[model samples]
Target: MASTVCGWCGDRTHMTMVTDLYQLPEGLWPTKGYSATPDRDLPVWMAAFRCPNENCQRLSIGWAPLHRAKMGPTKDLFLREQLNWEPTQIRRPAFPDVPKEIADTASEAHACLSIGAARGAVALARAVVEATAKAKGITMHGIAPKIAAMREQDIISPLTEQTSHQIRKDGNSIAHGDIGEELMSLDDAAAILEFMDALLDEVFQRPAKLTRLSERGTQQAPGGSADGATPVQGGADFSTPH
Candidate 1:
């Protein structure tokens, strides 16, 4: 078996093996599997998998170097080796266990939401997740897909579907065009960010422990700030430690 240092931590994590069977020629399974074994290289057909950190309970997705031939073939690879495997259409991430970071972002998002600024809401929500992931040593790219997969695993509530969809749309707006006038309202942005923060909190920790806006207060629409700026929401005080 072989090992590599986890990107988030210097701790050397041994490779574990996983295998998945794909339909031949027709290309039925778009994704492949990896073994838990650290030494096994990716076969032309298989995808590589590794733990994001030695202490993490979940695994991360990665492609083996093309020249190495260290993994098994994609189609014939066995999935059983993964033990606790979950297939995803896109790459999955290794989120760390950090609640305080998420709480801070949520607080900022709440403040933005209180103001009713769409752009600010979106920007703050993105910042919260990005910062949380960074502190925990996770990546933000493809985070939406990762959340979607987590939903499918029933690790979080199905209600997350709406939040994931909105985030995807928000990302598209930022990348391709303006956030649009409708998105400028603080209330609209706050609601979306609140949902997003809830989702991240669930992903990083226990689902039951996730935040619920309904429990806190009515889902108020953002109004305007003191100087006629966009309406904003109150900062969230997570009385319970994350």
Candidate 2:
């Protein structure tokens, strides 16, 4: 009787159609008055709904038996039409705390991946590397070159050519490859994410320069103690023989 625009089509109002008792399968029809069936039957109680939109006259045709679905608040979580169909509930996730360094690496790795959804992971790794380098007073540009220089000066260890090669390869992939081309499986994505984070930790995280018990040592503590130590109480040099 009343006209209401279809949510999907926007141009046409929803219309309902009804079927005669003979039209329905014998056993499926309600035994009592034609109107005795439940609300769900009301739809089937009649014919399916059709979109009024002339251009997109989509039909809402389906076989749904009488049933009840628990509905929830329609304000924030639920859609209006959903109330007419099936009910659903919403829940929020309980997020855990993440370490700053790990968070940074993940952000960087995410930025580096062009293929698939792994871009986020790559960006995280890159962010971690860049941030850590900056904190260590290292240059962000020409990272491989900077790393090489540090290796040569014995500032960093185990800086193999492989590391540089991987960075270049990964960089090229992220920069030039089609994002949709190389969609990796969940396992592969996880592995790569782990690798990225581990690599950042391995190379970028400067180890706490062996914080010695006392600064007065025979030889400068191997990694050249960065933590400046002070003389023992009474200005007594711990290095002096008793």
Global lDDT of each candidate: 0.46, 0.40
Could you report the Cα RMSD, in angstroms, for every candidate shown? 19.0, 20.9
Worst lDDT run of 10 residues, candidate 1, spans 83-92
Per residue, candidate 1 scores C-alpha lDDT tens digits across 128-241 of 544544444444466565555555656556776667667656755764566565434433564676567566766665442333433333444334334433223456444655
Write down the TM-score of every candidate. 0.36, 0.35
Output the lDDT of residue 40, model 1. Answer: 28
Which ranges in model 2 have alpha carbons more than 4 Å from their true place? 1-116, 159-161, 164-168, 176-180, 203-206, 209-242
What TM-score does candidate 1 get on C-alpha atoms? Answer: 0.36
